[model samples]
Target: MFKLTTAAAEQVMRAAKEGGTEGMSLRLAATQKEDGAIDYRMGFDAATEEDIRFQSEGVDIVMSPEDVPLLDETVMDFVEIEPGKPHFIFLNPKDPTYQPPADA
Candidate 1:
């Protein structure tokens, strides 16, 4: 199962509220690139009948069945990589370039 850090959940909630999608689930999708990198996309969206639904940190999330293998074991986090530049990041072990955090 995919996980969302607390910071990421908070940020997603904020974005959803600001975008007037208070009741919509956050849809997450991922595709593996030819170079063995993962491409991630996420946003507020309504869940379809075929979507898999789950809850993490009080946030609703939906994804297609096809995305499960690619996203499984992935972690999403919100971090400030530089001053005043916070963004969501995907930490996926399946990615060739992915490195485990020093603290891990």
Candidate 2:
């Protein structure tokens, strides 16, 4: 239960268009680093055993269920911090009406 921002959606759509894929999705998943730190990633594909794809407007983002709890009400934002080094920000828990998944 999530929505994409105009900018984020546009960026994703552009990427999908470039790739020329018939379908696209964005998946959000979590993983543990070698140091036991938890991290997340966004991928493009359909939902699978370890990947969940968020597809909309020709954009595809693949992720894992392990990160669903952290992605609730998350908003993707882009920032031009420096010259060409743009950064994407994850604004989590942004919606008061949003609910997070129970498990990680």
Candidate 3:
């Protein structure tokens, strides 16, 4: 399951509304590259049958089914870095681990 915070949802919804497209929904999707790395993309006024629409705080974020796995147990957060630099950050529950040093 994916989680979208109120702030993130609002910002996305506002942007979509300003795009002046009817029935437009924010879409979030990810794809596996040739190197097996997953990448994410966001769009406004874009959607497909394969996309999953997120509804919260009167806002929606559409995502493709293929991108579901990559978004599993993920959470979206809003952050203010410096001035006039608000951004969204995706957090995954499953993070890579680092190996511990061997006993000397």
Candidate 4:
């Protein structure tokens, strides 16, 4: 299963609140490119019957069945890469370009 860091969860909640999607789950999708890198997308959305639902870091999440294998063991995090600049990042072992954090 995929995991979300506390920082990521807080940011997700803030975005959901600002976007007026309080009741909707965060939909996550992944696509594998020709180069074997995984592209990730996320947004607030309603869950469909074919979607798989789960909760992480107190945030609701939904994903299609096809995304399971691609996202398995993935970790999503929000970090400040530079002063006053924060961004979301995916540490996916399945992605060819993935690199382990230096501190890890």
Off by over 4 Å in 1: none
Candidate 3: segments with Cα more than 4 A from true spot: 32-38, 95-104
The CA lDDT of each predicted structure is: 0.94, 0.60, 0.69, 0.96
Better candidate by TM-score, 1 or 4: 1
Clashes of 4: 0
Q: Which residue segments of model 4 deviate by more than 4 Å?
A: none
Task: Estimate the TM-score of every prediction.
Answer: 0.97, 0.60, 0.70, 0.96
Error of 4 at 63 (Å): 0.2
Where does candidate 2 stray beyond 4 Å? 32-38, 49-64, 93-104
- Relative to the unseen true structure, what is the C-alpha lDDT of residue 71 in candidate 2, on a scale of 0 to 100? 67
**Candidate 2 local lDDT, 1-104, one digit each (tens):** 44566777777766667877546566665554566444556655666766655654445666666676656556676556599987655555643433454677
On lDDT, the candidate that comes out on top is: 4
Candidate 2 lDDT trough over 10 residues, lowest sum = 92-101
Candidate 4's C-alpha lDDT? 0.96
Ten-residue region with minimum lDDT total, candidate 3: 93-102
Give candidate 3's error at residue 35 in angstroms. 8.0
How do these models rank on TM-score, best leading? 1, 4, 3, 2
